[model samples]
Target chain A: MTAVLRRPTAAAPRARGRRRMLPFSPRHIALIPIAFVFAVPLLQMFLAALSPSAELIQYPPPFIPSHLTLSGFQRLFAQSDILRWLGNTVIVSVVAIVSNLVLCSLAGYGFARLRFHGKNFGFFGILATIMIPTQVLMIPTFVMFASVGLTDTLGAAIVPWLASSFGVFLMRQFFLSLPAELEEAGLIDGCNRLQVFWRIVLPLAKPALATLAIFTLLGAWNDLVWPIIAINNPGAFTLQLGMANFQGVRRTDWALLMAGNVVATLPLVLFFVAAQKQFVATMTFSGLKG
Target chain B: MVTHTAVLRGSPSRARARRLGSAKRTVEGWGFVAPATILILGLSIFPAAWAFLLSLEKWNGFSTPTFLGGGNYAEIVGDQQFWDAFGHTALYVVLFVPASVLAGLVLALLLNGRIRFVGVYRTAIFVPFVVSPATTGILTNYLFDQQFGIVNHVLGVVGLPQQGWLTDRHQAMLVIAIMSLWGSAAFTTVIYLAALQDIPAELLEAAAIDGANRWQAFWKVVWPELAAVTVFVTIWQTVQATQLFDLVYTTTRGGPLNATETIVYYLWDTAFHQFQFGYGSAVAYVLFGGTLIVTLIFVLVSRRRSSEVI
Candidate 1:
């Protein structure tokens, strides 16, 4: 059933959408309160993190402290291996980022461009794994890694993440949107398939690659459960595990715990802010397609 | 779509080139995808089969397995704590999903119209989504602490009644729900915000010219356009809520009286805490089955609805 009714003519690039002549409208007045609801938790966390211990226990804690101090951060660095955990976090994040970029783009390119037997079923098999609950995989996967003696190492924490279902899906979607003619031209010019992909295709995939990198960075940095399941050694703790352990030992010490949370969370906050458009585009792409 | 185009172009070429060219293309294609297949399939599918096999046996983390057939599944069907966790999760999902969806959509609508500082507002909202769930758990635990927590402090200042948060069973659920909302809204809001932006302006203008006011125009014009997205958000949130482990694990650990224990958390507790690998695998399969059923319903319903509209 060959059905090609209409080639999708490129619509005008969706830029410069409906903008009112003046920025200030009755809408902005309405928006402030709603946005405030979303902003309050992060703000309160920051304020609490900044408050001195005396100020924190003073009956009713003030949102704006009379004076702010870095005693908590100082004590955090002085007492614990917070710096080591942050390093481990960076390693996992960077490895996961690079691996997802290369592996997912390669697989996504195969799904999008190449012709092979079992291609449809193979791709669908990958997609189906997205619906399989992560908990089901937990026991077997942990055992699988432990069998290979990689359980408490960084390898255990990052192996499953080297390629993600969502990363592959996103890359494939981006690749599909690209015109096949670009790759065909490379093939006609006596280039092999891999060369065509590396030279002619990958340069144009900067946006998709950026999206994959940001997604992996966020996922790897913020990951908690897998590290908990896989790595138990105190020295091997990822950032989240380190922060969790810090909270446990310093139970009532809200100042230090909140400070730890802020320290751990700040990089991701900075990352998202730097790549806001890419983040939003990824969100949009996933939602709209689903 | 790309695959369809490939098939269309591939057919005529196959007539002249026959199997050898196709065979060579297949090998090249496999070469590209094999690395991912080896990794993903090894990590995903192989484990799933292993899990299913483990579910049918009775084994702890150690010792040789004793085959128990359907005994674990039978036990799960009659388990009280399992059902208790199930009820707790249902309640959590009930409170969390609709509220986040509605809150996300409303904020998206408010922020939709050409506005200033949208990026600033978005960063403020989306910041929560990027923070580690465990970090969020720590932050919220402090915020909702009954006696010295700032949430209680603010409530007292506002002359509102101070109830025990993170203390009472029902109140603990509310606290977790609030925390879930704080973490979840950013992603949902971004989705809704983008969908709102994509709604063509001409459709809204057409409704206005037909004498529809803003609210009526939104209902008649914009609402239908967003139905698919709303469904997507709903299902995404549902699956995410069902896998709600890290937040509860960090905050309460199934808490004061098992009031907040969810399917995933309980699965973790059973598998890891009790070292009952077989039993844990059974519970995992149950969760997987339930998720698959729910997701299938959503997909089928949405598919039929879209096809009818076309």
Candidate 2:
């Protein structure tokens, strides 16, 4: 991950481009206002989540509160299933991250390295699934899960996410980038394909695997629609869906809802901060490929 | 939760197993792919076919589906709300797609070269992308709330009137567009940055040495390479924007005279809200067709462009 943050050796080329750069250059003194404009909404969200509920709703709208309090957090804890939702989210994310790392890496290794029959055809078939929107499948999936008696279960919530084609593709691409010599050496040393994958390729592919795991965790943590549709029981509700229940038709508790939002979003922000370097490079790469 | 089977080539425990290697390989392939294939088919493909069939029926979910033979499709064609939803989706694409792509392109260009803290900026911008649209939907509701929203507060500070961003029908879609913009622009920027890196520096330098300006070189050389990325983003944005329901459901529920009501939201309201499953199926198919057409156009254009480059 730190490798992504280190400046490239091609500084001379960048300097040449910089010499003729337009107003959009990174060094442009003019971009400050635009950057500030983009930053305000996020700043406001953070501030509003911290502000006292009454001050937030005041007519003049206190920009900066005199007394900052955790009353909203208290209200959220008292009113909603914040903890249970968090637990559910954690369970879902962990399962998804673990399964994606193991299964996707195995599958990706097979696709990238194996000489199995119908490999190309099978891979393309998987890619075709990307075109199908989830909405078109929602009702049928619900019916199928209900028939299997898996409805409202965490199994149902976590399974579809584990079959992430994007993860498979990312891992496969990384595996392709890896040298074949290590795996070949392992194979010659009487290790089987699965063993070679587990022992050799998997260790070498740590950066890519970590990237996939983080992405899966983030996705599962933030997902709302699938859980909402699959689970009718409140016990199974993930944080996002549970937080959405804040908008009860009769009354609006702005402070508590914002606080819940903060709680739900804060961990991800922390995670991003911790993994910022890897996250950016991986994001940059994933965008290009998919 | 299927366990990994003992390998025919490797497992000593299964050494005496009589299963033919060919048969075993075939079975293993299917087994490995089974969970994904079944889930996708059951949840996605089968439901899509069922939705198509249901579109011909006239049934609320409570009653048995009656074969009305295109009645639902006919009704959808004439329904003003269906068209309104289509119009709103189109309007959303018209406003959002370009803004997001341009924002993405500019940001990518800005962050393309070496900078000391480019990673921090990238992560900060991309943070919103990881946020569930549901959260964005809810957060934006508070942010754009006319009476107490931070948006209105900022506008008031600038001496502008506080607008009812989510309530006013005319303004509701714009709010949705802005939220969509915020979430999607990061992704586009990420994609564009990748594409920019893939461009050969020698070609760029050659153009620069030939006295062509940076803008000209970008237009002539960079945009062509970025074409594939652009097409990918547009098609994705179209599919997502067309099927947008989460944000709409959370923000406005298609209220304020059904102004912000998109096709999927309308379908949800009709199916789950009104229990008109047949009508909902019809609307779903219509959105599907819309997506298919848009996707086809993108594919055709990209194919042509790639061929031209070849």
Candidate 3:
């Protein structure tokens, strides 16, 4: 994990047409097949979704549909509670991103720069929690949620995610790497601690905040296990649970199910496109890759 | 938190003022950290402590849990289904960790070759990881549908035999593995790519100057530098493989004859579906024990190796 910290700040952009860096390079030829292997399943799913129902049932399931239609999506929204699911998912993700951004950074900045009682032990204790499997936590968490009347509510899903251990660790590390002179200047001006953090530190922490935001949003959006067990009400179900139920009920309907998948996944694709560089940087920097 | 240090280091101040300021920083530090600390300790450690109590009792979720000291653990040892699920998880870890790592390394190496439109290819590969696993399960289910799947269709078109994918109990775990591999390889590739980029060009240059082939250079120059990341990725993958629930939950529900039942899925089944709360907590503890053992062993081995190198 420490190795990831030494990651180069800026990767060298590939120098195209550099007079063949490798001898007898057949890179594209090799890559084309592997990329095709990686891409075709996703493309095939989209094609299946766009195809008419009868066409999808044909043998040798058409890789390229004869005609594209919105019928699959139309059926998904018209027949299932997909829009409700989308709304619930959006609310959950938005709340998660906002709360994590606020809480993790506040705590993270404290741990990073503050000299206080039990600071090292406190931070290390949180870091150690990262190793505990979510599975181990599931049973007791569900029991507690049930006892507290949180089960079957969006709160059950949102609460555990509010301030992830990793989020704090990442923010703390980011803060540590920041130049301290700026904060010292604010301190020298007779500003209180919280004011310095707000006025000087946080504004400078935008890149770290953005990175944390992206990761949290992605996790909350794509989460399944906790939501499935914790939130049983169809009304409270997130997009993943809604999609899972849709598959469970209509596994045979390839077109409609594929459409639901696309509905569930398309936003992530668009989001990734908008934030590719950050995603790449975070993925590289997040030593907790699992 | 940020105030005291700056003030203390500034030009001489009254002892009383400095002491007050120091105390203020301590209060502020606690204020900033308390919320997250309380939340984590409450949600994480608190539940874990209570779970130990739950593990000691035998009860359905509804009725009062009955104390059965040491009984749940005894039952687990004799439970054939538990052993089978444990075996399934072990097999999965053995197959998946290596397959994903290799596939990732191969992809990263290829991308590192600087093919045209590298960003496009990398994004296409990585997009799967961002898609929810439950959704990935559905996509793969549709892709591997027994009769209408694109996989069998392509195989048939290529004049090959079409094989049963998600059906025929034997192939269920394999199908799940393929889906996991697809998503996990994307993550592993990104990690490997970063590690690969960090390897010194001079090392590869040295290897090539010695007339080593690409394969030779990779084995001698690249792999050594990547050993640390490799250990991390393998351990990461192993832990993840053990908790293989989401994809399996949506896809197999632990399967035809329970052939695909991994430990976490079994734990979920026992606790949530069957409502055997005490036994489920017991299983959770066992899963924790297994994970701790694996992690401790890896940590020990890695520490020893690093010590030897130093």
Candidate 4:
């Protein structure tokens, strides 16, 4: 066994030595063109946002803007209900984030650690629900919401996103991976299940909760289809629905559209930058650990 | 309710106590899931059910739906336009989904190491996922625009003719496909990267010691572990492909003689534009039905595969 282990150990050194054969291996460089292609769209959006009128629409669009301008953004803020849309989006997303953190955690913890009857069965049922396409549910949901007179409210946007099957599943998986000893100790120390969950597991779950929040917020913020279907009133339009109005049937106002894009995209970028490290850490932990 | 609980609890009085406890737990459980469940069921499931009922009717959005029964279904089956849209979607899946899966997998495999700037590469690949698809669609529109787009401009320098990218029926779907790949490949890559990282290093070393080449090791060991990720990506891509509204809506508006018109786009037009709620509901149901069948098939296949593995 020792001899066999020694051969593999020795092989590692040879592999390291062989690494010197290429200055920059071709494989590593293969990602460059693809990454560049991915980055170009974002760059152009930035360029379009900066370029002056007639410049953006000009044939053979300018590769780079001669001078940057914030006119589009200013126009966006000045004309449209951009601020209202932003406020609406923030409200919906914040509600979704908070609710998901609490509700998903409770359900996830229940499924993960608590000894409940039909636990496995319930989980599998939830898992099975994942396969049902959301498309089928949309029309019925609209009718139901309309009956309750909740059709035009932000509540329609906020509520559906809060209880994702995936969020519960993610949290459950994370909870299962955690050592039960800590929670068990808390229990022995006169902590009930709810108390143990509140003080012990909740703090430990910041990363997963954040990841859930990020995804939930992004989903809620960028949602176009539901808002379009649910809200005909301009007062209720989220940023996406509000911005889409720029593409009029006859002619699109590219400047306003570009402005709207910038306004809509900025918050997401800020959120990503602020929580990027935590986001990445959680992604790897939740996705890979499974 | 008390008697029902008593029966379940086995001793009448004990059962009563258990019933109360269980009822409270059930209520709590429902409360936990209430907001989301209610909304989803209302907005999603309820709409779907009403749509299905509407599929059997003939109504404008404003009018009372007249019963059409199976006529709409028959009409959909005979509708050449629906088939054309379906064909476009199939073509899209063929061109875009596989190419994306391969690109994502390759990126994950290439970057699944402690290389210098690996984090940078990973982030660069994933940045697109966070960017709005509508923005990406617009950017791609300009890039691949025939006359003055950067793509044709590049091709022009290469002495190649500028293709009518968004305007040409044949090329329109390709441009949208490319945009779709650009927007979604990042998420797929990240998921694949996660899957790749889960692969044990010892397995690779063991395979290498057994004289398996890098290619052999990847196929035998790495690919199996990635099977789940592959399924996830494929299902996601398929669903996203069928729901190909955003990019198509933004870039082509299902235009250039409806070359890029997907089922969802068609449905949107029927319901929102034409006010043919009943007909649109039929289309929606058909799409839902197709998706359901596909999902069922995938689930069955995966389950069987798992069983076989076990």
Candidate 5:
């Protein structure tokens, strides 16, 4: 067993080095087609957004337009509150990211390092709620919000995004995986727990924090269901809510609908492209251990 | 306890100081957890408990709530619409979970090798997952439109007859399932890819030397390593399938004779649209209970299977 394990470690690097020299691999033939199939929808969305309205409504709609036009984009901007919706979405996402980082890290640190009464019970209680589907909670949550006069406001969207059980669990798991020695040393050096967390531990937790921020941002930015239930006020619509309503109202305007889709999706796609490494890392980490 | 005893052995004053420090530590711990604890309690635990209570009462969001004492749940049992929605959700899970997982596994296996442009391939596969389900739904609607869709155009190009996609009740759910798979298979792909990379190359080489073919080697080696992840993916996918709303809401609105009405969609339509909060709450609890039971069953079965293998 030991020899088998040792052989791989020794052989793996050299094999990789040899494989890198090949100009092309047979795998590309299969991969290229799969990648094209996967990429076509996004490509289509962009193309349709720029396609002429006549071409968009044509039978078996033209794959490529005779000439690209900005009319769809012009109409999207002029006809809807797309800009305000984008602004609201950004505000929601920013607030969610900040609050999740602060609250989840604090709670996670407490669970990971502090010895308090009911520590296990509290942690497990929060973790247990992760199994409860959000669908079950929406009605009562809406009722509660309505009773508080928070319905039809951005608060309904922002309030739930303020903190999450998964955020707390993720932070705690990351904290636990870290070495305790540095923290112990900080305590010995006369720093308070908060100071230690702020000055010493947080700097080390940047990667985990980034992962949390990314997930929170994505969730808040793309949220549609709750916003649909809560916010009917056109002024308070997030990008997704606005887009959904846009589609509903303009069922036949393919160009306008595609334009809205592009605007709503481009930011996230760009973010994913820029931070592809962290994006993949976050997904794998969450999927395997969440 | 050990610290207290140790300090007591050292000096009386030190023992008192240690107790004070521990008390301070406890306070600090509570301070750290208080904000998150309150939020979770208020948002999750309280709402869940409140939903259970509301399930037993009738309220239309404007008037006084009247207690029904399990009447709503009893009604749910006999309600054909609820059962129809349940059946639709079940069908969705059946269509979605296996196909997504299998597609993910295939994509992961393909991408895991010593390949060129691995990063590019990964991004292509993953971009759809990053796109919101609502956007995906809109894209699906246009792409699969009965009269003008690119899908029908492709069928025509291929010398096959064009078919109604989202419009046909027989094919609407299947279209939704395919769209969902397109958007979400990348999640499982990323997961399985991570697991695949962790498997040692020597094991496959050893199996090859032992005269095991690729299929035999995969079944005997790779499959076992992936069993736990498969369970996790299945349960997650099932939960997602049960909560299928955004796509349907965006595209079908449970349309063409209510063929695509899922539990959550039906629940939303009942409460928000029809003002049947009490009935909706009952539907919600049934969904919650069903999800919990299914998750538990998956865990238990996987546990027993793994133990038997051990």
Candidate 6:
């Protein structure tokens, strides 16, 4: 069993070296254009943001800018509430990440380890809610929030994201995959369940927690429709909501719009680049289980 | 919920002590799960139930709601605008799902091999998936702009006549589909790549040794292995396609003549724009019911096929 597992890792580097020595391969021939096509939208967004306002209005604007300018960004900052919107988005995303990590982990650990009656019923019930489309729930949710005076408030945006069924499911899956022995040892050493989870299990669960945090951040940050419905107050707008409204109201201002898109998109792209491995891992995990 | 008295009554003293310990565990378990349970119930399940109740009432956001007794649903059956939006949504699903799934599968197969700059290619392809759909839509509007967009510029450079892109009713939905694919195909690619890596190398090697060519081996082996992932991607994409609000809201606002008015967009227009909350909830239910039926069909069919394969 050990040899079988070890052979693939042992063979990987040598195989990579051999492939590296080949000057060109059919795969490269096929992939180059595909990658370029996939990458053009992002490149376009950045370049267009840098293009001068005068040039953007021209017929068939230059693919590459005449000369880069920060005028669009300057105008964006000067004229809009973009910074305020971005701050609100950050607050929403951070609260979401922290709440999801805490609430989902506690609930997930309980579902994974605790022997409560109706545990199966409760867990599956939560899981089943994943299929209930968010579009259908929005009206009632909006009404409920309005009744509680959450409408048009940042709290409206923050409430729905506090915890997610997917987060709980993810944490539970991660916890289940862990060897229970370490937790059992903690329990034997006179640590209670909560302590065993916090001190031992949570430290080991760093990867899952990171994955959950990244997903939660992405979801909360990019959320558009709910925020638009629930928060019309300009002061409470999240970045995506603000950008959408900006685009609608100022459709003619190409440079400003592009700059706004850049501002909205760049942070996430940079975050993905910084944590590329974790981002990919999160995608793979979600794809497999989703 | 768990009754302590029943456990103690049926047990000896030692057993009673253990039962008490289990009772304590049950309480602790509930304590751990309570927060998430309450939140999910309050925010998701309760709202879903309320949506159903709201569907059967007539209200205009401010006035007292009068019970409609399925009148909203009855109107929906004959509502021409609702049907048009539903048709548009269907068109979007038809256009978006297969194209993205196929493109993703092709890209994944291409990347699955040992190659130079594999990391660069993967990153380039997957970056778009990370961008918000609203931003993608904004970019699409500019890139495909009728007059000054780069897409038309490229067409002009090649001597083809420039066409109105998003501004034209005939072409708007297709443009939306292409933009959506650009943003989403990478997701399916990532999933497919992972599934491809899981195929045992030895199985492919054995097929090669037995004189099967690459294409044959792929069809006879790799293709079958991809069935599950394909189903997942299709269902996910279809669900996403149904909730196609962000893109339309940003770019078209369901127009160049409502050509892109999807069900969700229509529902939003109804409830929020027109303040017809009751009718909008009914529309929401229709969409929910349709999505549920479609998803159930996919799951059931996949289960049967997998069982047959076994």
- Which structure among the candidates has the greatest DockQ? 6
Docking class of 2: acceptable
Better of 1 and 4 by DockQ: 1
lDDT tens digits, residue span B1-310, model 5: 3444565766758867777777877787889998998898789888988889989999897899999999999999999999999999999999999999898888977777544577788889998978997799899999999988999999998999989999999999999999899898889987887777677767877877797666787898888978888888888888889999999998899987999999999999999999988889999999989898999999999999999999
Q: Candidate 6 residues B186-273, lDDT tens each?
A: 7888788777777777777777678766678788878888898889999988988998999999889999898999999999999998
lDDT of 3 by residue, A77-135 (tens): 88899999899889989999998888899899999998877788778778778777787
lDDT per prediction? 0.81, 0.74, 0.82, 0.71, 0.86, 0.86
Least lDDT summed over 10 consecutive residues: which range in candidate 5 chain B? B1-10
Candidate 5 deviant stretches above 4 angstroms: A1-24, B1-19
- CAPRI verdict (incorrect, acceptable, medium, high) for model 4: acceptable
The TM-scores of chain A alone, one per candidate, are 0.87, 0.88, 0.90, 0.85, 0.91, 0.91
Q: Residue A290 CA error for candidate 6 (Å)?
A: 3.2
Across B1-310, the per-residue lDDT of candidate 2 in tens digits comes to: 0123434446775545544554666565554444554544444556778877877887765567799888998898789988998888888888888888888888877766666556556655677777777778878887888887778888999999779888898999999999888877777887776677667777777877898776788787788878878888887777777888888877888878888888887777777667777788777777777789979988998898799878
What is every candidate's C-alpha DockQ against the true complex, given to 2 decimals?
Answer: 0.41, 0.36, 0.49, 0.29, 0.50, 0.52
Error of 1 at B206 (Å): 1.9
TM for every model, in the order presented, reads 0.90, 0.88, 0.92, 0.85, 0.93, 0.93
Question: What does DockQ come to for candidate 5?
Answer: 0.50
Q: Candidate 5 iRMS, in Å?
A: 4.6
iRMS per model in Å: 6.9, 3.8, 4.2, 6.4, 4.6, 4.3
Cα lDDT tens digits for candidate 3, B143-206: 8888988888888989999888777678888888888898767888988888887776667666
Worst 10 residues of 5 chain A by lDDT: A1-10
lDDT of 3 at B200: 69
Candidate number with the higher lDDT (2 or 6)? 6
lDDT of 4 by residue, A124-148 (tens): 6666556556555555556656767
Q: If ranked by DockQ, best first, what sequence of candidates would result?
A: 6, 5, 3, 1, 2, 4
